[model samples]
Target: MSRLLVTGGAGFIGSNFVHHVMEHSDDEVVVLDKMTYAGNAASLEGLPESRFTFVRGDICDRELVDRLVSGVDAVVHFAAESHNDNSLANPEPFITTNLYGTFALLEAVRKHDVRYHHISTDEVYGDLELDDPEKFHETTPYKPSSPYSASKAGSDLLVRAWARSFGVRATLSNCSNNYGPRQHVEKFIPRQITNVIDGIRPKLYGQGLNVRDWIHVDDHNAAVLLILERGEIGQTYLIGANGEQDNKTVIEKILTLMGQPADAYDHVNDRPGHDMRYAIDASRLREELGWEPTYKDFDAGLAATVEWYRANEGWWRPQKAAVEAKYAAQGQ
Candidate 1:
């Protein structure tokens, strides 16, 4: 069995990936996360201690990273400050964690001679200007608009550079937006679910026209494993459900699923430089690795997600209150 290191393994996607990897393989996982406000250890609650190990640390610590990478067969880099609004409010943490921390992990992986899998986002391609939203391909140029996406773009480049310069076997997968269980409630989908349940208005921005391809976390996790196992070294793959839904549409869908009315939403000022759309082309992943998304229908998955929140208020209430308190203190 391969011993793997998963950075940011406590966050939403990372946490889901960890569960997916463990369930599908006999691998031992070492999760390195700082447990930042976004990174909560509770996500992995009740996981068998023998199958998983949690390390409270930052990816930027080169010494710790080197030691962690030394014995692992592979490393999956998933740690990042991923919110656009927060990135706009403060970009420094995004640069430091997303870019420099990624560099540190690359250095460690290079020294250890381990395979590296870098998880990335579709935002690196920036907003889509074309009328017909063709899926974003692996060859799409990096034209990130927000500080968050820009930082991720910089990290992606570093991964490529490390492979060319140091001969580190590395693969990349940029996926569309993900929603599933254990996601931090501050995200759009979860926020909407929680708000409607708590008798508050779901907030929308900019007419909610921004389009995103939604994928369930489980499907994204499966695609990541496919890339790690069958993807060509030094190649970039794009993973998606090909399920494109706009922000407003997604909110309305949630309302319908939760049996709430559309009038319950409160439209707010748009986020500055919000990407009008993000879509991904998964043709390469499908043709090359035979990886296909199973959760293409957002309604079922979204309804399940809302139910998860309803059933696990204890899991998210503290986190939700803390995040809200932080924003309230900032007068956001």
Candidate 2:
């Protein structure tokens, strides 16, 4: 069985990857997570003890990273300061974690000669015009608009440089927006879902015309596994499911599926420097790796996500007040 060290494995995508690896392959997983506000230990509950282990630590810890890298056949780097709003408020953590933390992991993998995969977002390519038909691809020029995207952009460059200069066995994937079970309430989909669950009207950003290419977290992780296993080293793959929809339509879908009026949501001031659109062209991943998303229908995925929040209120409730409070403070 392949042994994997999954950084940020308690967070939404990483936890799902751990579960996916366990369920789909004969792999043992070691989860290295900092247990940030974004990472929840409970999300990783019920992993088979025989095949799974969780370590509470930061990816910035080079010694720990080296020790962990020594034991794993591969390292899937997912730890990052991911919230855009939080990054705008305080960019220090983003610089420290996204850049330096990635540096540490790269060094460890280079030293240990382990296979590595970096998870990134299409936000690194900045926004496209609402009418633009082009999507972010492997060769898209970097034009990050926010601290979060800039930091991620820098991280992706680091992986590329390490692969070429130091010959680190690494591949990278930049995925579009992801929505599914176990997502933190602060993210767009979960925020609206939890808000609706609390008898509060969902909040939409100004006009809600901004477009995002959404992909189910499971589909994203499935593609990640394919890349980690069979993708070309030093190559970049874009992971998308051709699920592009505007924010207005996504919110309305959530509301309608939740048995509420599509117009029940309220429009709030949009965040500063909000990207107008983010689209990903995953033709390389699909054609090269033969990957496909199981949740071909967005409505079906949103329905499942809504049910997850309804059934696991305890998992999201404790973080709800604080997340909304932070947003309220920002007047978002």
Which number leads on TM-score? 2
Candidate 1: residue pairs that collide: none
lDDT by residue for model 1 (1-332), tens: 99999999999999989989878999999999999988877888877789898999999999999999997999998999999889998999999999999999998888879999999999999868537646689888899999999999999999999999999899999999999998998898998888888877788886888888899999999999989998999999998987788889989988888888866687777778888888888999999899877776778888889899999898788877766666556543
For candidate 2, what is the lDDT?
0.94
Off by over 4 Å in 1: 325-332
RMSD for all candidates, in order, please: 1.4, 0.7
**Poorest 10 consecutive residues of model 2 by lDDT?**
323-332
Task: List runs of model 2 lying over 4 Å from the truth.
Answer: none
TM-score of 2: 0.99
lDDT, residue 328, model 1: 51
lDDT of 2 at 258: 88
The digit string of per-residue lDDT tens for model 2 on 246-287 reads 999999999899899989988899988999999898999989
Give the top-scoring candidate (lDDT): 2
Stretch of 10 with least lDDT, candidate 1? 323-332
Counting clashing residue pairs in each candidate, in order, gives 0, 0
